[model samples]
Target chain A: MIIQREAVLLFAGLAVVLAVATAIGWTLKRFLAEGAPHPTIDNLNARINAWWVMVVVIGLGAALGRTALVVLFALVSFFALREFLTLAPTRRGDHLALSFAFFFVLPVQYYLVAIEWYGLFAIFVPVYVFLALPILAALRSDITRFLERTAVVQWGVMISVYCISHVPALLMLQIPRYEGRSLLLVLFLLAVVQASDVLQYVCGKLFGRRKVAPQLSPSKTLAGLVGGAASAIALGAALGRLTPFGVVGAAGIAAVIVAMGFLGGLVMSAIKRDLGVKDWGAMIEGHGGMLDRLDSVCFAAPVFFHLTRYFYT
Target chain B: MRLLPQLLGKAVTGLMRLLTGAQARWVGCGPAPTQRIYFANHTSHGDFVLIWTCLPPSLRAMTRPVAGADYWLAGGLRRYLITNVLNGVLIDRDKATRTRDPIEVILAALGEGWSLIVFPEGTRNVGAELLPFRSGIYHVARQRPEVELVPVWIDNLNRVLPKGDVLPVPLLCSATFGTPTRLREGEGKDAFLARLCRAILALRPA
Candidate 1:
């Protein structure tokens, strides 16, 4: 796949925005927050730095063509699943099934995506993996909390591998007239979701008072939702060129992405609360884990992919 | 000449770190470069590998894991991996066919300026509670009173690659090093082993 002109423009625009963010973070730290214990500013800088690393990684993957991007997301699913199952109650009985999930299910799902086998990749995890793993676990006959254990394993593969795999699966869509530009659809989804996250965090700090759900996620607030989601929707409209969707369509889709991404974070937070962990795993700085960073993407990607395929393709 | 073994050493350590996070928490003491014995609970065969990978590379070269000869010497590949790649010390479990005393061989490794990773639990404990510790740790510590015994708790490795599982699931695992204790001058064998056992179990993640 040749380097599309639109993709290059999108990348350059993202790089400029990241550079500006880095400049702001450095200025705030070097002058305003110097010699003082400012956790928020430090955390903001750390988050910006992590974003730099992530952009570089995704850029490199896109540069290498279709196979590289699929492989990269395969690794992403692998790490995210590892973090999810770490806090889960997987006993000795679940070993075989768990190994199969890691070794067999993960790579094959991504392989199907890479080859653009829409039929197999679509139902592979939801149909095949969902049914097989429980049988494997039941073979060991460890009947203590059997249903709960198998359900957690199913939920883990669904969220981590099946859901997250849809990001790369976006590349396989053959949208008419938007040929060779489905990569931009990926860019749009990521931009809207991540922008919503950063905006929500900033809005929460500035004007948030009433906690949205103090039980599940303490940091989320009503003001953050309205302020952040509204801004991200506008950002999506501005990024309308990337998607086949025009300005209004872009904003409408961005609204869907924001709502799904918000609920996705809450669902993951509930799982963390149930498991009694502050973070999924300490894989990234300022970000809790691979799953923590990808939780919103995990929910947004599948919905965005299906929407694009059903209407646009 | 030595390049192949050295490369193999780094590769094995890298793979172990990748499979298990092999994250080292220096809770009690820093990973200071010193000739000390690290005694931990026996659960997975990967126990010592995790601990070995947790150590600083400068220390990893001089650290040797004490593995059972029956397991490590079972095949030609196992022999090559244990002796060449991992730099492990294979101790005989059966006394009938053994010529040299296992304790004496361990002491000889110490004399060669090598720190050892010993499992005091003798065998893998499939259950939640720790098994009764073997007396080898007491004897090794008693003879080398100068060596500090650092109790390491290997968390989640057993779950990472449990018994009879061929492949390890990529789970986050940690090896926590605790405060070093030494065998006192008048400490009895049972008392010394019991103390070390408690020290190891104390570092279990709450």
Candidate 2:
């Protein structure tokens, strides 16, 4: 088979789950909410519909081989960066530098990852872009809020570009007995993390009583986090065939991914609060924005990449 | 054939939407195809482009951006973009050199059933508030009281691609299309322009 059997199984499993979810969402909308509008049900259905599109796109990328997957992620990084920077406060002085970040720095980082130039991809944004862009901003000579501008541009590149690139960088890992199956690592990380997110939302909507952090995210609860992480850990253990890790090892890493993904959500929520906006933009119908979808992955990808590189590679 | 220019036009408009998001919030009105004079505050040169980009394709084809002949006809690329791609109406801003009255030219476009996107501020205002609207808008409204006057507020464009900048910072800009206003029965020139300016300002994102 051109694609791994496990990957094909994962795709089929996702399609069936989404189909059932769509059915349930439709039944709930049709029967439960006869008079008053149901916000939660409508939101769930919209999310599920969007998930169908996303799953198909990712599945296609996985089937098309590594270059296609890398290119797909490159476009994801582009949209994610756009959403992050759109809400971020910037000045006219930052135009040239900002252009460099978008046009030059973003593509170069992805290119380095595609070519597996690990030495440069790891530090391109953190070292070179961090050092150089501020110089360009400084040259414009608008010193009002200079420090904030510099920090934000650097942070956007880091979170949106550098960190998100780590997902594709997983393909560059040299693990024994994992030849021609590196795509599965990405599939595994995505499945575990995203399942954790969905589980958290479902658990929160149903059994959640105690708020995890009422101020950071109103929707999250302690019950949601605990229930979701436990389920995702079980899921990861079951999918051990996809990874170099055994069931226990996969379960441990799933725990780490869930924790990091939770932190990533909180941090991004705090940023939205600071920006005084709901969601990043109207890019996505119900999911808020690209950044909203990728926030968990942004925080989890780098740690997962490094962990796999250190322990298994 | 002008096929290349038309294709380039689509690509450039798409690029503009991609950069600024050019989201049209039809708060006070729907995006119905009607003969309306869409007026907005002038900040950057991209103001009308953003407004034009926000229109529905049905309205976009009939919408003509009102620009100054002095600028659009200044050179090669700008002239080509303004004429072929945007299909803009070049008004003679200079009273001294213009043979045709700017209001007549605008009314002519309206007579031909084309909607016009006009920046009523006469010139770009880089300050905190809008400049006093040029009386040309009031004249257009007076002449064509039948045509609806939609006040559009283009937010954050100056911050995105302000004057003297070639590349934009890719900020999220929105064009808030307020309820269509018309010159009242007894409204004077200054009063009508003031009402229009206030309407545009009211739509600014809080």
Candidate 3:
């Protein structure tokens, strides 16, 4: 009987989510019709298509609720971490540290989030694993580039472990109306953050004139920044009901997400440039790595988490 | 089963192009060439795959890779892939005498108009220096003097997938197809092998 009720509720929820996506997609189509160029229109259409698929998955998973969604987030963290380490250089001595990072630390961090052990999830990588992995490396006694090697191991843990695990850390939030909606919060953050990236690329291609940071990211532009951020803010505001935020409050939150997302893109782009690589790693089709997709997530996850925890909690 | 190998071939080729920027180009002209021997230096596991992947689809159908029967036979997955899908000619290197010639099998493949890839170096080596030819390739070449001897120099493959490493790291590679040479009149076996090795070494990028 409860299963039937849950099934009906899931069906209804999916229908509503798809309905909203379709409505927004059509609205964006109409908006594109006014002044957007042909290629921009086509690219935005492609993004919308991808967005629909992402939404369908997220919506269905959310309908199933907390545990399933956390598993999905954990998978994302694993893939992202895998990509991170795959691109990062390692030596014979660092093999143990690398193995531990990928196999042990990644699961432990996500498991903490899964059990709603917020305190440990927050510091497992930074505190315990962070200190421990280096000691494991130090014991090797085959120390070549001891400092540099340790730093790379430490940085891999920081970027892949600490930053990425923050996404699932959303589950610990305890808002009154949004008590069971932390999964929704994660979905909202990912959608808006990723959408802004796609929109900015489209906008920049169509109307980009002044390069935002030519040296760092030649493709980025100020026009893309304004247009993409504005669109993200609007999308965030419209989807405000997913959170405890109202229209104005949502816009403010959206602004923060857009800002951080842009910074995240910049930082990741810079990291790629430093590595003398075009992409982080070949994990995503036509895109680079796990970090390539989650560049914004890395920044946006923690920012959104703290903002919501401060105000809504 | 065939579809999976073909798909895997495409994926691996695509990956090689992406990682190493190594491109394969077939040279020389021939008409349904049969009983031919392709001899090159052995550097990485990719040596066979790279050569196999580079061959024309039509030609790939009948070609057999001479893999160590020991290594390929031991691993279950490797055995299936090599013996069945890859259609490799696995031979026992350790238990074999001069009479137990793998080249005879390659010669049989040639008699059936199937091309064969053989590594002159019996083992994988990292250095640029070509190891002494095992005389098996020479024996094959001598037996089939009519067959076109394609000298394939696989450069930087040692760096791409180095010795004792399981995972392949991307490094720029090139497979140079040098002019075909045959055993000259009255060319001694030792002198002939030396000349063939030098021809392969000459194909290295200056």
Candidate 4:
């Protein structure tokens, strides 16, 4: 009954958000269709439609509580890892190790988190799995770019699985007075990260002139970064009732998340540039893939997790 | 009983698509309802399944993979997967069995209006380079002259589930179907095979 009530409230909130976004998108479409079809407005409308779908899906998962939410994030990690490895230059020698990473290592890491084995969950992929995978690749006896190949797989697992897992792992945190409400922390992180992304895109399109890193990500701009971070921080502060953090604390934390998320997006963009592929895979319309959606979240999750664990827990 | 296998087939194909992330790219020709022989380079055991799953659901029902009987029939699970789930036509790859010709079996399956998927490589290769295609494709093309022979290049499957590996790693694999080629009146066996190989290879992303 409590879970049902929570689900109802979350769904209601999401419906309201979607309604407002849809209205804005419709108005923009109508206004921008006068002369020539504006590509930016069309893309924005597409992104808003995608956000509606993404929000409903994630909101349902969050409302379902621990197990379903964990499963949802696991699937996200699975697809994100798939997108990363799809473009990454992998050899036949890396097959066994990669198999272990996807089927065994990724699942086991999430399983540890599900079972609340905090110690193992923290170190499983980074320390144990990291050392084990390179050895698995070495057994194939293909030394051609062995280091690069192994590093690609290792970094992919770390970013996609290890980092993304922390969002749901937030549900496992034993924060004082935060019982039965850790799901909100997950939502908080998602909202801030996503809001930062959306806001950044909007700001960049409106008033962007100076490029952040033209070679890495042509879309990101300095004006977008400042405005988006400020907006996300404000939203985070307003949502402080959901967490143990007060308004000012939530603002500080939100700023940290936004900054880290920005860096994460940049880093992922750099990796994509190095790999010479655009947008990972075309799973999500306008967003590319699961990794593209979660790039900022990947960097912010670990930091938010550790911060929550150290201070609140 | 029939519905069960269909459901299982859908589930298996869905899982295969998710795990392999196999994107079906129709490069040279769009998908048609006509009977076809989708031949691809074999790298991993998952080649046929990846190619089969990439087909539109309407086409999936009619497309059956021509697999080696020795491999698929060895295990009970594999046997069920090949026969029931995939609706595979298992051919005895062993040359010792002179009883029924593998091409005749494929042709019989084709006679029933089902498209056949054949791996011209016969066996899985461990490298990026394609092994010289065997004579089976040439024979099949000769037998089913009306059926379209589409060359599919299945890239990155070797890294996803390489030879001798049971557990498949979740890597991005793609099945790129090229333009259908037909056997010419004067083309030699080696020339036809080489052309088929070239067609498949051309679909690979640079």
Residues forming the 10-long window of minimal summed lDDT in candidate 4 chain A: A1-10
Assess candidate 3 and give its lDDT: 0.72
Better of 3 and 4 by DockQ: 4
As for candidate 3, its interface RMSD to one decimal place is: 6.7
Would you list the clashing residue pairs of candidate 4?
none
- List the global CA lDDT of all models: 0.90, 0.89, 0.72, 0.87
After TM-score superposition, what is the CA distance of residue A226 in candidate 4 from its true location, in Å? 2.2
lDDT of 4 by residue, B87-155 (tens): 889889888875788889988998999998898888988777889888988987887778889988988
Q: Which candidate number would show the highest DockQ if scored against the true structure?
A: 1
Q: Give the per-residue lDDT digits (tens) of candidate 3, residues A186-254.
A: 766776887788779878877989998998889899998889889989988877766678888888988
From the highest DockQ down, the ranking of the candidates is: 1, 4, 2, 3
Q: lDDT of model 3 at residue A279?
A: 72
Best by TM-score: 2
In the range B40-101, model 2's lDDT, one tens digit per residue, is 98899898889888987778889999999999999999999999989999999888888999
Q: What docking grade applies to model 2? A: medium
The CAPRI-style docking tier of model 4 reads medium
lDDT of 1 by residue, A1-313 (tens): 3337777777898899999999999899989998476898888888899999999898888878888888999999988998998889989999999999999999899989988999999999889999999999999999999999999999999999999999999999998888887778877888899999989988988899999999999999999988999999999999987788889899999999999999999999999999999899878778879998988899999999999889888
Candidate 3 docking: what grade? Answer: incorrect
Docking class of 1: high
B98 Cα displacement, candidate 4 (Å): 1.5
Residues A142-245, candidate 2: write the lDDT tens digits.
99999999999888989888898999899999899878788999999999999999999999889999998888799999989999989998999999868899
